[model samples]
Target: MIRVVVVDDQAVVRAGFRTILESEPDIQVVGEAADGADAVSVARRCRPDVVLMDVRMPRVDGITATARLAGPAVVDPLTVLVVTTFDLDQYVFAALRSGASGFMLKDVEPEELVTAVRVVAAGEGLVAPGAMRRLIVEFARVGWPRATGPLPDLTARERETWLLVTRGLSNVEIAAELMVSPSTVKTHVGNLLAKLGCRDRVQAVVLAYERGVVRPGLP
Candidate 1:
C-alpha cells in the first residue's frame, strides 16, 4: 500500500482528502496534520510514501515544510504533493525549486489526485495544474535578466533533450519527437541532470526557462 499523510489547515479539506484516498485499496492515509508543524511531525513519524501538503498554513507555509521534508537540502526526502488553491506562478516555481515531487490544485478531481500520489510514490514528478503557463510566464519574465549563449556547457544532444523536457514532453514523447528510444532519452536526461546539477526534471524545466534555453509558450 502507498502510505499517505494529509496536511491542511482546514479540517474539512483534510477530511475530504482522507476520504477520497482511503477509498482506494492501494492507498492508505497514515496520519493527518492541520498545520505545517504537525505536518512535519506526521511525516517523520509516518514516513508516508506521499504527502498531500497545503501551500498556506499556520506556523510554517507549505514551501518551508516541503523544503524541510523534501527539499534538495534533505539527505533522504519524502515525496510531497503540494495541494494548493492558488495557481500563482510564484507558488508553482517555488514549490518545484523546494523539491516537491508534484503540485496540484486543491480542486483537482479525486482520480487525478490518486494518480498523482501513485506517480510521486513511484518516484516520478508531476507539475501542478496550469503549471506550463505559469512556468513559461515566470521563466520568460525572469530568464533573460542574465542572458547568455545556449547553456555553454550542454552538448548539442543534451540541449535538445533539455528543450524537450522544458516543453513538458514526457520521456516517451521526447523519444518520439527526436526519433530515439525512451531509454536513450532517459540517458540524455540523466546526463543533463548531472551536468546541470538538477535534482529532477522539474528543476531542469525551471532552469531551462530561467536561462532562456527554452522560451515560454513554445510547444
Candidate 2:
C-alpha cells in the first residue's frame, strides 16, 4: 500500500483528500496534520511514503517543512508533494529547491493526483515541462545566485543527457534525440543524477540552471 500523510490547515481539505485517496484500494491515509509543525511530527511518527503538503500553513510553511523532511541535509529523506491552491512560479521553485519531489495545483483531477502520488513514491519527479520552463524563467528573472565552485565532472554523454532533461525531454524523447535506446537514456540520466547529487529530476533541472549547464532564453 502507498501510505500518505495529508497536511493542510483546513480540516475540510484534509478530510476531502483522505476520502479521495482512501477510495483507492492501493492507497492509505496514515495520518493528517493541520499545520506545518504538526505535519513534521505526524510524518516522523507515521513514516509515510508520501506527504501531501499545503504551501501556506501557519507556523512552518510547506517549503520549510519540505526542506526539513526531504532536503539534502536529511540522512533519510521522505518524498513530499506540494499541493497548493496557488500556481505561483515562486512556490513551485521553492518547493523543488526544498527537495519536494512534485508540485501540483490543489484543483488537480483525482486521477492525476493518484498518479502523482504513485510517481513520487516511485522516486520520480512530477513537474510538467511547461511548469519547469516557467520555474526556470522565474529563477532567472529574480537573479538567483549561480552555483559556485567547480562543477561535477560528467562525461560528454552525461552532460548531453542533463541538457536534454533541462529541456523537459522524457527518456523516450531523449532516446530518439540521441539515437539510442530508451534504457541507455535512462542510464545516462541516472548517472547524471548521481554525479550531481540530486534527489530527483526536478532538483537536477534546478541544478542544471544554477550551474549554467542550461541557460535561460535559449532555443
The global C-alpha lDDT for each of the candidates, from Candidate 1 onward, is 0.82, 0.86
Against the true structure, candidate 1 has what lDDT? 0.82
- Clash pairs, candidate 1, are none
Per-residue CA lDDT of candidate 1, range 119-173, in tens? 8888766765366666567656765333355554888999899887776677898
Give lDDT tens digits, candidate 2, residues 1-219.
Answer: 999999999999999999999999999999999888999999999999999999998899999999999988899899999987755678767878888988778887888789889988988877766666766677678765577668789999998888888877878999999999999998898888898888788788888777777777775
What TM-score does candidate 2 get on C-alpha atoms? 0.90
* Top of the candidates by lDDT: 2
Candidate 1, residue 155: the lDDT equals: 87
